[model samples]
Structures are given as structure tokens and as C-alpha cells.
Target: MKVTNVHTRRIHQPKEKVSKLFKTLATTNDLIWPYENWPAIKFLEGLNVGSKGGHGSIRYTIIEFNEDDYIKFQFSRPEGFMGTHEFKIEALNENQTEIRHEINIQTTFETSLLWIFVIRWLHDALIEDAFNKVENYFTEAKKKATYNFWVKLLREIYKRKPLQTKIA
Candidate 1:
């Protein structure tokens, strides 16, 4: 199966300020990834083109890293995820920006089932949490994320597996 998935958030901050996120992505001090509660997203040799990284049980390689604008990671694990997932920033105005997280993948039969039944649920929840953090940073507003029962359940499962605590 070939799939394209995207998640986006509107941030009420200057695009210049928002763009700083790209500089520390997948690093120990990242502001976007909620690594304190979830698995770290780390680039084994720093975040640059051709670097490698992962979160939880998924692994990927950085194929593109365009400063302040976009980054793309091609999946390398949980087999059959052939394609890249990327984060893109689009300036909406002087005081607002749009952040889009997207993934395009062609999967094998077994991996398709994994995506349909498992990975999608976890992925959505994780990104929701990520966006909430970003919103908090710019708006100083408290955002609440309500997960479906399955996402909540999957979180418990994923939390059991320990990965490095590199990204914040």
C-alpha cells in the first residue's frame, strides 16, 4: 500500500522564532519532541543530511535537512516503509506559521497491516502531544489532548520499551 499522511498545527509566533526548531531537531535539547515522556528521537551523528534516527521502535535516516523550513526522514525499520516522513514550516504571516508533519510510504503486505492496526494509532497520539507542546510554547495556553482508548493503550505498551533519553 502507498500512503500519505499529514498533521499540521497553527502557531501564533513569528516564523523566524518557529524556524529555530529545525536546528535542534532530534537532538537532546529539542523543544518540539516531548522526549521527557516519550522515547527520544536522535540522529546518531547529529541532525544533518544522511544522519540516522529513531523514536520508540521505528528507525529512519535523514535524507534532507533544509534549515528553518523542512526536514525529511526515510524509514529504515519495521520493514516496508519505503519513503520519507517530513516536517515542514510555512509562514502564514509575520506573527503566525503553519507546521506540517507528513509521511509518504509504500508498504509491504505485513507492514501495511502494522500501519493499519498499530503504528497509525501511536503515531497520531505522539504527534498530537508534540503539537500541544509547540502550542504551549507560543501561546502560553494550556492545551489538552484526549486520546482514543486505543492510543492510550498503545502509549502504555510503548512506554515499557526504553530508548535513550537524548531529545528534549
Candidate 2:
């Protein structure tokens, strides 16, 4: 099965400021990834081309990196995931920028089932929460992403028997 997923958020901030957030990714000062509530993204050699890391059961290597513009990661774990995911920053205007997270991959039959029943719900919620975190950082008003019933339930289950969030 071919899966293509994209999530984006527009922030009312300068492109430079928005772009700076990319540098903090997977770091102690990360302000984008909703790591406080979910699994934190970590890399063995930090954020750079060839650095390997991922959150939860997902593992990937940084295939490309551009400090203030883009980052792409190619998946290597979770069995049947085959392809890449990337984050892009686009300037819409002098003071507005968009952050986009895109995933493109082909999945095996078994992984398709996992994606349809479990990972899809969790992944969507996770991205939304991450976007909310990014948006909240620049605005006085906070943004929050709510989870659907399935995501809430699945998160509870995982908390009991946590997946291998660390890459080997």
C-alpha cells in the first residue's frame, strides 16, 4: 500500500524566526515536537545529514539537512515501512511561514494493517500536537490538539507496554 500523509501549520512569524526552530529539533531545547507528551525524537549524532534517530517505533536516518529550510529522513525500521518523511519551511510572506511535515511510503500488507488500525491515528495526533506546540511558541494564545477516542485509547495502551522508542 502506498501512503502519503502531510500536515502543515502556518505561523504568523517571520520566516527566519520560524526557520530557526529547525535547529533545535531533537535537542534539549526542542520547541516543535510535542516531546513533553509523546516520545521524544533523538539522534545518535544529533541533527545533521547521516544522523540516525526516530520517535517511538519509527526509526530513520537523516538523508538530507538544510539548517533553516528543510530536513528529510528515510525510514529503516518498523519492518515494512519503506520510504521517507520530511519537514519543510516555506515563506508565505515577510511575516508568515508554513511548516509542513510530509510522509511518503509503501507499506507491506501487514504494515498496512498496522498503519490503518493503529499508527495512522497516533501519527495524526502526534503531528497535530507538534504543530500546536510550534504555533503556541510564537503567539501569546496557546494552541492545543485534541486526540480522538482511538488515539487516546492507543496512547493508554502504549504507556502500559511502551514500544522500543530508542533505535538500536
Candidate No. with top lDDT: 2
TM-score of each: 0.91, 0.98
Clashing residue pairs in candidate 1 (N, C-alpha, C atoms within 3 angstroms)? 28-166
TM-score of 2: 0.98
**lDDT by residue for model 2 over 1-112, one digit each (tens)?**
9999999989999989988877889999998888989999999999979998999989999999988899999999888999999999999999999999999999999999
Steric clash pairs (candidate 2):
none
Q: Which segments of model 2 are wrong by more than 4 Å?
A: none
* TM-score of candidate 1 on Cα atoms, chains taken together: 0.91
The segments of candidate 1 whose C-alpha lies over 4 angstroms from its true place after superposition are 160-168
- In candidate 2, how many Å is residue 168 off? 1.6
Superposition-based RMSD of candidate 2 using all C-alpha atoms, in angstroms: 0.8
List model 1 lDDT by residue over 65-93, tens digit each. Answer: 88889988888887788988999998999
The best candidate by TM-score is 2
